[model samples]
Target: MTPSAPPPFSTLIRTASQQQHTEAESSTFMGDLLGGRLGVEAYARYTEQLWFVYRALEEGARALVDDPVAGPFIRPELMRTGALARDLAHLRGEGWRDTAVPLPATSAYADRVTQCARSWPAGYVAHHYTRYLGDLSGGQIIRDRAERTWGFTRRGDGVRFYVFEEIPNPAAFKRSYRELLDGVRVDEVERRRVVEECGRAFALNTAVFRELGEEFPLSA
Candidate 1:
């Protein structure tokens, strides 16, 4: 009998990192934040942390615009820096940038995105896939929760980060993105490295959550 074909790259990535992904989601901070135990202040602080990360990711994408391996994934619609800034401004007032600071874990996460985007295209894709796809998928639930819980206007100034004005069909876009991952040329070793980097991305995200949990401990 013939051997089975290898799994698709997207499936490989999901299967390889499933446990870590769950851990990141189930972290104390995420648990509190998602369960509505935390207030809008906590959510705003989380957005501030995201600003540092997306800034690095988008700036790095600017440098990689010409890369043969990375260029195809450089989607203008996926860029979140501007939306994040607007969200922060609405949440924190005009001087949000002047006062916002990255938590230590956030700095490290941003640094890793910068490093990979500059050096390893596949690794950069690992982070890009982790974040933007999550934003498209699970992030929709987050947007709904924030809106209902905090009374933010629907798809208005406050929750602009979750609104994708460019992409009419997020599900189709995600499928096309996964197909691109499957088509990208990479050897066995590089594929393994990319999968591993995806795990690291989740870990870094969990660290940020852990720090947030510490800062905003749950009440009795």
Candidate 2:
């Protein structure tokens, strides 16, 4: 009898981190924001936190642009800093940068991404996958919510961060991204580490949402 083939690495990672992913998705802040229970200020504040996190994620990408483990995932089209900045400006005017500040959870999240990008390129893949793939997937729900709730123009300035103008086909891009993950040149030990890091990334994201929930509790 032939033994069954093991699941692909992408499947392993996703299955391993499924709980954390669900928890992040089900966080109160996200639920409130997506449900339109929160006001536009809450949404703007959330976008501000994203700006800091994406800056860290993208700023570190330049150093890893040639790394064997992380390089393949560093597609320029996935960059979000400029889009985040545009969203902030539209939400908070030209001086948004002056007022933009990271929540404590956000600072920690960004710092972790920076650390992984600088020290462990393979681990950086966990963060890259957790974030950009998520943006291409569930993040669209956010773009739709923002448009409907806040009356932002469809894929316009306020929600530009969620729009992937470069990737005409997000579903296709995500499939290719999963292929990269499955083919990553890591041994079993490092693959497990990357999987663990994916969980950590989701936990960190949930922390941000938890803090935002505290900051913008639902009204009676």
Candidate 3:
């Protein structure tokens, strides 16, 4: 069964907080390493140049800015994949790539997330990736979009963020999600906190998207 959606407010904060955490997760591993957000070599490319790969990654990261459904369920990688694909269609369609949005300097949180993902002891990276894949495989719209658009199939030249093998059907994977949540019993207060955080996550994303939309605009 799906984890009971926490209360409205707790979910809000959790979702919002989680969004930042997710972006930080990507940046921690992908950003500084790639040229995108002051990281290393990029995993993918954009604008037919290696430099554009950073932009493509950011474009991919920015997709979760306003997603409400992100926090309640525990698979962010999956969430990002779906959102990234649609944004690609939008960002690529018009000339939004050239738009200027301030890329904030790295923060403490981002730094930590990177450390966690990078120093992921043993199977952490693989575990994290599995969680993300679980979210994407659900017959949900986000996964569907990513499966079609967000290119993660190739290797070598880019597309390093995904784990293409070892996982089974998304539906089967997701069936266990509810059980995962059910095991983590929280009180009314903690539950409220989670819900609130989720909402915050959505609000933050909304603001981010609203601003970007204004600068970029979906279409005419």
Candidate 4:
């Protein structure tokens, strides 16, 4: 009898995160936000929350840029903090930095990212993969909806975070990203830990969506 092959790390992370991923995508807030049922202010609030999370993620990326396991995936084209800053400024005006505030869930999420960046490179990769890959994928849908509903030009001032202007082909970029995930070298225990962190990342995202639902209330 042949032995079973070990699952790829990408598969492990995806499978473990499926439940939370489904819940986060299916959240009422997400539905309304993407469906164009929410106002521009709600989207701006979401953007504000992203700034906090990305600040932590990018800062962590700088710290782990030389780590063997994490360094390979740190592509400059994937960085969005500058784009996010531009979007926030366009949405909230020049005083955006002073006025922006992270949702409680966002603050917690940032804290976790900081902790992982400082102590565990593989752990940092989990959060990094969760946010950036998701941004390159489903995040585009949100960007389109925001532009259509709010009158922001495609890849223009307010939607710059999703633009990926530096990346000529998003599909190819994503394929390369998945390949990197598949190739990351880690032991079974560490791989499993990273998978769990991916699930936690999704849960953190869901909490933010739930809080948004409380504030926006799908009916409104």
lDDT of 2 by residue, 101-135 (tens): 89999999999999999999998889999999999
Off by over 4 Å in 2: none
TM-score for predicted model 3 compared with the true structure: 0.37
The predicted structure with the larger lDDT, 1 or 4, is 1
Which pairs clash inside model 1? Answer: none
Candidate 2 backbone collisions, by pair: none
Superposed Cα deviation of residue 90, candidate 3 (Å): 18
lDDT of 1: 0.91
RMSD of each: 1.1, 1.1, 13.1, 1.2
lDDT of 4 by residue, 81-113 (tens): 999999998998989999888889989999999
Candidate number that wins on lDDT, 2 or 3: 2
Listed in order, each prediction's TM-score against the native is: 0.97, 0.98, 0.37, 0.96
Which candidate tops lDDT?
2
Predictions in order: lDDT: 0.91, 0.93, 0.34, 0.90
Q: 1-220 in candidate 3: lDDT tens per residue?
A: 8998654432343344565455533433222223233211121222112122223323333443333332233343343343333344343444534552232221222232233334421112222222343234421332233334444333211232233333346556545554444433455565454445334333433343333334333231
lDDT of 1 by residue, 9-36 (tens): 9899989988997898788887777788
**Candidate 2 lDDT trough over 10 residues, lowest sum:** 211-220
In model 3, how large is the Cα lDDT of residue 38?
Answer: 20
lDDT of 1 at 81: 93
Question: What lDDT, from 0 to 1, does candidate 2 have?
Answer: 0.93
